[model samples]
Target: MSALRIALADDQALVRAGLRALLERQGVEIAFEADDGQALLDRLQDTPVDVVLSDIRMPGVDGIAALERLRERGDRTPVLLLTTFDDSELLLRATEAGAQGFLLKDAAPEDLHEAIVRVAGGDTLLQPVSTEPVRARYRYHADDAPRALFSEREVSVLRLMAGGYSNKEIARAMFLAEGTVKNYVSVILEKLDTRDRTRAVLKAITLRVI
Candidate 1:
């Protein structure tokens, strides 16, 4: 089989060098390297890699911003974000910005390799798929109105949305009427206080609601 071509983008030369060595040992080729998101984009104009591994923070144009620009330019290249910290808000932004996968810089080499391959094969590597962590993030004040809670079915709908299922597809999969699914989505948006389904899902993930 042909080797996987991967690109690295990070302000830290040491980090990129380590990742390059590690990935090369795994039978992957370094397609290119960039120090920031803008440089990555400029390079991508000519070089096409199977996947992009980028640091979440850089001097200019962070990973999330790069992913957004990629989307705006209709670039479907899969991107995996690397972070040095577990910042929930940044994670949410990355998801919303259309990152295919992400990992902490210190993630196991095996896991990192697997994540790159999986994302290249069209899978997302978001964490805490189970809801317990999400539930733990929920906090409410007694004086304030009870935080909006989605029903079991609504949460199911939101999960499908996160998986990129259309409303019609979600309705068919959930075995609910199309109109019912629409209503559920509307309710989900309201509960999450988001303007759209994408934001709703991202916000829900951030709030640990889904």
Candidate 2:
């Protein structure tokens, strides 16, 4: 695969520098950098990248507000928030605001790289903190979730997908061939009526299907 290109936004110069260094070592190209949310938005208008890593709190428009604006304007690029470990409330807000995933500031370099890759690859949310706050909020009562419509094995595969397992990993865990796992993923997507794993998981959550 070609190198994954990424855009970064953070007010702290030191933090940005450290992250750039770390992410560079992880092999993704840093397309651009912005000091705040407004700046990030402006930069993104002209630059294209596979992912965006942004700080949740900033001087002007914060990360959640920026993500809201991005979705409002129809930008579907996956975004990962940078947060401190105790920012459960902010994390909850980020989830409600449609953030794809997030990274803890104190996470190891490999963990940070994995989070970015998962989000860019359209995987489900890999939350670093407790999702209790998020669960308590944003409870959707959609009747279209098709609860109990999944077969037992499909439910197992869906749970693994929600946990961000790749087809290869799921195949190994389930003692199935990788091709079989791919087939399962296709069926899961079809049953969920979603084109991607991320949306499928979100829909499942909205309907309490898994």
Cα-based TM-score, every candidate: 0.67, 0.71
TM-score of candidate 2 to 2 decimals: 0.71
lDDT (Cα, 0-100) at 5 in candidate 1:
94
Per-residue alpha-carbon lDDT of candidate 2 for residues 131-198, written as tens digits (9 for 90 to 100): 45444554555555553377888878877877778888889899999999899888888877778886
Off by over 4 Å in 1: 128-210
Top model number, TM-score: 2
The segments of candidate 2 whose C-alpha lies over 4 angstroms from its true place after superposition are 90-93, 135-159, 166-169, 176-210
Candidate 1 per-residue lDDT over residues 122-200, each given as its tens digit: 7766552333433345443343331577778888888887765667878899898999999988888776666776566
The lDDT per prediction is: 0.78, 0.80
